[model samples]
Target: MNYAIAYVVYNPTVEQIERINEISFGHPVYVYDNSETISELPYNKDIVLVRNGRNDGIAVGLNILLETASGDGRSHIITMDQDSLIDDHFIKKLISLAGVDDREIIVAPMHHTGDITYDKDLVGKSSQKLYVLTTMTSGNLLNVQFAIDVGKFEEKYFIDYVDHEFCLRANRKGYKVVISKDLKMEHSLGHSEQKFSLLSLEFVPTFHAPVRRIYMTRNRSDVWRKYFAIYPRWVLRDFMRFNKELLGIVVFEDNKLIKVYSIVAGFYLFIMNRWGKAELRYLVNGAKK
Candidate 1:
């Protein structure tokens, strides 16, 4: 399958650049840099870099990649984050798995470092393919035409839940999200911390700053509101996940009061249908209150 490899970078390290170049060996690569100022990259014929003057967030950058792939007549596109590491044949593996089913619009590899387990009951022991509720953008091979058909990533989401929203949209359109349990790649979720709560026992949550917490909460709520009616079981499961996360933030994280405030503010924005980046000054000033 002739496919394009793309990475959305934001002030990436030399190690990340080198790793991407290595993994993307023979395929054409599109690098969308969302840094404040463009940085020069080492010359490589297989690599094409585009620098957005300012950070337009992940959703926008991904759309740019999809456009490039579609315009070049590529059938599929593998999207990756700057820090994600994959083998040279990662795309080939995903493509092979995708060949089993025509409805499989997205095929993702399992993460080596993050949550690697999928619901066993939902997948069963007989199958290597696990139909999941959602899959992250990184390390996933996307059918370009199907992705565009599902309306691409939600730009309003800006940063968080971009992948989840896309997967849910695809599912609604009868496209399957299949994960190859055998295929795994090195990827990191975020700066996570292990926290022990007296009430809930043990928990490890990805530690996000107050501002990022706002985006996470807001986007999550937005997605929940949109899909809860259609996918009640999945939505309820996600609701439980959110509550657990909120409890962890309240009981275990620092700046508890402000983080709680951000969560509330995020809900408020979601209820009002407000999207995009929240004003930092307002959050800071409100924190003083």
Candidate 2:
């Protein structure tokens, strides 16, 4: 069975990608470069670089790769972030564990080497029978068919919770998202930093994005709206729990506009039945200006 390692990048350091290529030598590297133009990627033939006309978000970029992987007849598509150090044995382990009939989405463990101390409870435990939710696309090996089936990461989400949303959808479809405790990788989280006013929100060593404060703020409501349509009370309870925590995080600590924008987005998501569309329109306007 063929497998491809795919990455989505925007104005990322060429050296870092090159280093990843060095680690995963002899495999086909598919990179969707969403920057202004596809800059020079590291390798030659094995590397396929798809350039978007402008800077699209990571979710859209990964969807491009998901399309490629599904069509190419590859059994597994390893989705990774540009700014991560993948384990040398990641591909080998995933390929070994992958069962065509098993219906599993694999997520590998990630360690943060930055300021936050490692917490076993947070990143260590699995949910129900499923794998623990760690970071994003960095350490994930997904069945290409599963991705294609679930519509390949909601582009409406743009970036934030795209992975979580994908995982949630996969679980709803009866696919078990499992984490391999053995495979180890380290991530330089929030490599995509944004400047809000003069004070830039420094990179947190996890999935935190200020610009994606829009996506993060809005898309979870999409999760609630869409998912709760099927499982009502349970998803509603979960939504309240998640939004309450998210409210504190954004309102108390984040940038004023981003915070207010999140509030507006989240409120509309709950009341207007728009879920994520309202925020998408807001982003479209922001992109225009």
Clashes per candidate, residues 3 or more apart or on different chains: 0, 0
Number of backbone clashes in candidate 1: 0
TM-score of every prediction relative to native: 0.90, 0.71
lDDT of 1 by residue, 1-289 (tens): 8788889988887788787777657667888888886456552557877775788889999998998899989988889898777776776677677656787788888765443345721422236877877877898888998989899999987798999888888988998888787898776656764446466455666767777778888999888889998777777877877888788887777778888888888888898888876765638734432
Candidate 2, 267: how far from true, in Å?
A: 4.4
> How many angstroms is residue 246 displaced in model 2 relative to the true structure, after the best TM-score fit?
4.8
- lDDT score, candidate 1, position 244: 81
Please provide, for model 2 over 136-236, each residue's C-alpha lDDT reduced to its tens digit, 9 standing for 90 to 100.
56767778877788677877665667876776676677766665556667655444233222134332322344445555556766767677776565456
- In model 2, the runs with Cα more than 4 Å from the true position are 38-43, 110-135, 188-209, 229-258, 265-289
Off by over 4 Å in 1: 40-45, 112-117, 120-126, 193-197, 283-289
RMSD (CA, angstroms), candidate 2 = 6.2
Model 1: colliding residue pairs: none
